[model samples]
Target: MNDNILNTDREELVARLIDRPESFTDKQLEQILADDECRALYDTAIQVMHSIEPKLETNVEAEWNRFSMLHSRYRRSQRKWWKVAAMLAVVLMSGLAYATIQHMKQETWSEQKATESIVSDDTTTKTTENKQDTMQVQTSIAQPRTFENTSLDLLVGVLAEHYGMRVQVMNDEAGQLRLYYEWNPALSIEQVVDQLNTFEKVNITVNDHTLTIE
Candidate 1:
């Protein structure tokens, strides 16, 4: 016979024997025992059924209770897996949220520091520029003007005006100094006095606001 037909027959024999073993007649047992495969299947089924329950419950309610217990345990196992998966999802989302917040905070802090540094640099630069402007103004006020092709007596008069002093020529040699070369206009009154002392046969003295040249 085909495998399907054989399996069907084996299922029927196992079910009938498990339900009522004493219902089968002696003639039917003899016929089933004549086939070795059927006899072995029957013997194994009887052993399994007896091992399961010595006095098997015959009511539908007893079978339903057994099935419900097995199904409940299976459902509990499935719910446990779902619970674990839900907790893992929650943890992963929390981690992502924390990382995003930290990144945003770090970016904000960096930008704020950069802005502060730029403002500080600008303030320092403006302060330095103002100081330089003030120094330049003071230098312009104290600066002397250039002289070109000027005589000694006239230069002495100009120097008197430049130094805010009186010019005096005590000897004829004092009026003979003629300057042809360029002189730096930034020279101080003390420096000019020292230069005037280098002339031949000249004696110069500066006392407060009077210039005496001999």
Candidate 2:
């Protein structure tokens, strides 16, 4: 047979193996059993299919009997190949399944870490606000509160809440560093946001009750 024709037949055989392996005719099964390439393709297809969607129950004895009956000469020159193919199918399916589970676990862990970080920061911000309030009560009214080495996010949050405004960090290019400056309670929300805009590349916009940093 021509190489092109053989390849076409092998491709069709592999497709049928994936979609409907049980429907293979006795002649087709015999061809697959005789050809090393076809057997390899069959093993690979079985491995992939089993990995993606595994059956809940499988009868080993029944399946082996059915496969034996499909080709009467299954034991002639292909018995060793059949055994090797079955073993390879099992190992490949197990490996793929393990890899998929590991990937899912990694993604889940990443999401959990992100959630913990956000919650921790929010809790810390609330605690810091409470401590500042306590310190203000003990200190003189003549002294103005100053912010130094404060996270930009925390500073923006404090300003937004105090001025009854909404603060938005619009882009990744925006500053994400600590601030070191004196806080003036008398400054308007726009002036405060302008003070917070320390980065040269960032653009800060204050419109009515909203402040945006990009």
Candidate 3:
């Protein structure tokens, strides 16, 4: 087509001719049909537009399907990850609870053992004191005498002075002297034995509360 003719009001006519070749007036139609260049340009533009239209449609459909598949997979992957995270959280919580329970159980057992030990030690001390008092009362009337080279009275006196114990020495009907040492609630049996054993001449026997010295 002539550039001037294409630039004038013929552009719309040219577009219309391309849309429908049989719709133009006879004169305009004759002008377009006689110009081989214009006719060839129009035919070529129409063929190009037609060829691209289905490919464009197919490309759009394919892109939409790809986007949908990607979106669906992303959502499924996110859900799967969430489930795994939730399971891990549950396992961590369970482990923490189990460890806490075990720790508590061990603490409780340790406390129980400590309490029992204290009670046992206290009971033993009280029993030793009670027996000593009974022996002292039984021997209070007898006269003090010597046995095993150390006088019973001297042994009792030393215990009284050093350990705050009250001791009494007496002789039984068999003429054998018995020494009764006074009990102290605070004194341990081991402590009492240690003190008495310091004097090698005396032989000592520790009953529940009483320390018998010969």
Candidate 4:
């Protein structure tokens, strides 16, 4: 016979033996044991079937319980991670809100300070202007004295005699008498001028009012 026919026959025989091993007739047993190769193949098939048989019902239950416990632990671990993630999100949001509030407060305070500084500067400027106006008003109210022609000549003569100075009288743009003096030593000019300005008979003021030298 061909190899394919022989293998098919052997497989069919093994299947029948596995299906009804106790019902095997003596003739079937003799056929299976007639060749050493056939006997070895039958033994191997029977051993394989026994090895592959389903486990006991109790063992199956135990395996199922172990799988359930392992699955439950895995689910618990996943839930814990989820909770940690949620807490982290909440904390981050709270921190963000606090930071935002702090920044706004700082900005508000800065703006307020800037406004206060501006107001203070404006007040200071106004006070300074007021003080200057008061001083000017006081100066405007002061009276000046007049000088006689003879007193003026006497004053010039005194300046020439005591300080070795020469005095010149000229007319200003407003047709008023302007007194000028020259001294021999240039350094003595300021001193001579100051002394002449103190003379009681000379009018030393140059504005609209007369200032009598005293």
The candidate maximizing lDDT is 2
**Residue 45 alpha-carbon offset, candidate 1, angstroms:** 99
Cα lDDT of candidate 1 equals: 0.65
Tell me how far the alpha carbon of residue 44 in candidate 3 is from the true structure, in angstroms, after superposition: 43
Per-residue lDDT value at 151 in model 3: 43
The 10-residue segment of model 1 with minimum total lDDT is 1-10
Better of 1 and 3 by TM-score: 1
- The better candidate by lDDT, 2 or 4, is 2
For candidate 3, the TM-score is 0.20
Model 2, 191: alpha-carbon shift in Å?
A: 2.1
- Candidate 3 per-residue lDDT, tens place, 65-89, comes to 6455323434555777878978997
Clashing pairs in 4: none
Q: After superposition, how far is residue 181 of candidate 4 from its true place, in Å?
A: 99
- The local distance difference test score of each candidate is 0.65, 0.65, 0.57, 0.53
lDDT minimum window of 10 residues, candidate 3: 141-150
* Candidates' RMSD to native: 52.2, 30.5, 45.3, 52.5
Shift of residue 168 alpha carbon in model 1, Å: 1.1
lDDT of 4 by residue, 89-138 (tens): 79988997897699667656765775778877556655665697688655
Provide TM-scores for the models.
Answer: 0.31, 0.31, 0.20, 0.20
| Range of the 10 consecutive residues with the lowest summed lDDT in candidate 2 | 66-75
Residue-wise C-alpha lDDT for candidate 1, range 154-176, written one tens digit per residue:
76677777668898888666566
